[model samples]
Target: MGKIKKRLKNFKAPDALLLICILMAMVSILTYLIPAGEYTRFLDPETGKEMVDPNSFHYIENTPVGPWKVLSSVHQGLVESAGITSFLFIIGGAFGVLNSTGALEALISRTATRLKGKEKLVVIFFVTLWALGGAFLGNFEECLAFLPMQITLCLALGFDSITGVVIGICGVAVGYIGGVMNPFTLGISQQIAQLPPYSGIGFRLVLWLATLTVTIVYIYRYADKIHKNPQLSLSYEVDKASKYREEISSNIEFSIRHKLVLISFVLAVIGIVYGVIVFQFYLGEMAAVFILLTIVMACISDKPVNETVNAFVNGAADLLYPCLCVGFARGLTIIMMEGHILDVIVHSLTGVLGKLPSIVSAPLSFIVISIINLFVPSGSGKAVIVMPILVPMADVLGITRQTVALAYHMGDGITNLLSPAEATIMVALGLMKISYGKWIKWFWKLVLLWYLIGIIACIIAVNIGFGPF
Candidate 1:
């Protein structure tokens, strides 16, 4: 009992996040299982006509069994999606290995030396880079690779590790939601909503820039404070001698073998970027590249090929539980879609609030989407689910689809810093030993303010007839 208690106490934030996600999934499944009202009929997209069927739509459950069965069914598909789970595992494993490699340390050492007196500037630069990169790259994984460097830089700059955690994780999240060039979510949403592909790029660009600026300002203010208050900075507990010993113990120092590992990682990155830019490879192929790269890196580091494969496997093991949890969350989407719960939720909200004027409707839509984001973390996924409803509502309310998109972006961006659903947030919190509640207490005010700024910017943009509006 004592040993079990101690082990639980030592569990990291990522572990906690995974645990919580699992619990939530269980609860969601239970909700699905409960007996409920009769399933309602709706227009089937395939037939473009109204259909009446008991099992075809979601109902208000009065008992638990039905919902749980639906949830279980959805989970099966999500778990079977090799692309999503494997991609997550590969990224997590690569990051773990990279951190253990001391390449991150070298980068941070160089950055610290150069950024000694430019703490505020560094924060702004990184915020802008992450936001822009996230928007362009369209994958959160790209930001994940650079996160350790961001944390090291923040520590060197005398800020709390939480600051780097927030800026890097949430900054990319913000840009991702407000994506200007993203072809996946944004393009799909626009197309489904009867808008042209990349139709509102000019407007989205303005919003992205504005949101990025706001994020930079918020981080810079905090950076200035930390620059002055050394007490708040990261505790650099490892002395130079200890660091050397640790590096040596981990066998992470530069050597002929290590150099080859680094070269392999570099080439992998090149392949990924080229594939993304020129070939437009999907995420599955992108994940395969990373998996293959990790194997190559392990081999080049002098581990036997089989041992290297096992090392990657072992490193990726931690991801399995969390990926399963993510699978459950994905199942929620499938169930909601299958059950028509999504339509119900959207219809209820639109019935009550869809009649407002454009100016009022825009911000309200943003708030609703942001609130929804608390439950659904994937921006692309959420956009797909919500844009259909939001677009029609916007059209009815005399608002443009672009305005609704801007609102969705703002709401999604502002909440990333606070949502426990975000995997990167869990990773950052784990590395820093920061509690989710504590971190939120520290940054909630700033997040709220940033949201306000974003809303104001949206209003201004709408007034100026930006994008489709």
Candidate 2:
């Protein structure tokens, strides 16, 4: 009990739930402080997409949400975000069903026994696999389905939960920020900027490689340090209480049923990747695949239907806190939209960026967008909102529009690891039971390094006139 208290002390921020409520209140107050304004949106004939008119900015009547409405917005946020909310629930329940078969455990045990001395290799392999998914597929939220499994694998290998988190979440985040071929951020931003799809691939490829290299090295060192001395881990106390540790054992059996389950798991994952790339499957489709996987696993293990249902329910029950975190985070966006200050904030920031000289503006574009990401966490959403204005701004300032897109993508992705406004990130933190403060304490230095890399990439893009424009 004393040990638990010591671990709780390391969580320097308020509980995740309280911190979200505090954010809700703060955004509500901004509804009063910030003037209400909006930009007119129009459909782009070229892209068939709705985009903000760079010229339209007008004050609207202030609609400051009071404490009562601020409180009520939580339900509205959940309703507004019902698709993703349901997606989390479905996946949680599905994974719950999958966990009942004992296959995941036996696989983890067998693999851990064989790879006992090659822990670093395991980290590198999984991190790289996740990075590829992010870089090529624009995968962030989808990665959550694998977080518990990855964390378990790391734990079985005698590393900490933070190590699993870095492997799963941070790996994907860096890949996303690199944005080499990510259709969501880089693709949409390019189309909006009037560049051919993937026009400046060479530069982005180099940037992706550079950023990923740094991420891999940093993650490996941390994993290595923790593996050597578990006491050195920041989450040492929290991890000690985890049930996953109990699954680690040398005498674990790897039965035929487990092998069949493992094969089915691999095939299901492969099918998901194929469906995502070939058919553009989103959350709904991915959820269906997981449900199918769960059923298949249950059949292979010959688990009774009643037992399976109970396991599914129990598994989903575990994810309630994370789901609430996501819903509350969505409420923050709802307040901003209702207050009509979201556009005003963007317009104001762009006006400041427009005034800066070209050299300063180039890199500063990255910094500005990074700041903006706090409010608009969606990459494609920001592309439509900010790109239309930035395109012309880049032209006037003699900065390549490609550089502007690079700035947009980099700025859009790097901060996701820390932003409470991001649903998936908050979900990841909730799953790991890590506080935002402790996350910052662990991740800030690496994020700063990524920011520095982004700044330098911006400067290089500027000096070299990166473009086929």
Best by lDDT: 2
- Per-residue lDDT tens digits of candidate 2, residues 1-469? 9999999875478767778899889989999999899999988888788999888889999989899989898998778777887888878887777677777888888888778798788778877887888889988888888878888889888898888877888778877888889999999999888888988888888888888888889889989898899998877898888754546766768889988988887898899889989999998898888888888888888988999989888878877888888888888888899999989998898889889887889889998888889888888888899998899989989999999999999998887876788888788787778788878888888898899999999998999999986
Q: Which residue ranges in model 1 land beyond 4 Å of their true spot? A: 1-85, 96-102, 119-122, 152-160, 227-263, 303-342, 422-424, 465-469
Q: Write the per-residue lDDT of candidate 1 for residues 349-405, one digit (tens) a residue.
A: 545556777787777777777777765666666765577667777767777777777
The TM-scores, one per candidate, come to 0.74, 0.96
- Candidate RMSDs in Å, in order, are 6.6, 3.1
- lDDT values of the candidates? 0.61, 0.85
Q: Which ten contiguous residues of candidate 2 have the minimum total lDDT?
A: 243-252
Residue 463 accuracy (lDDT) in model 2: 91
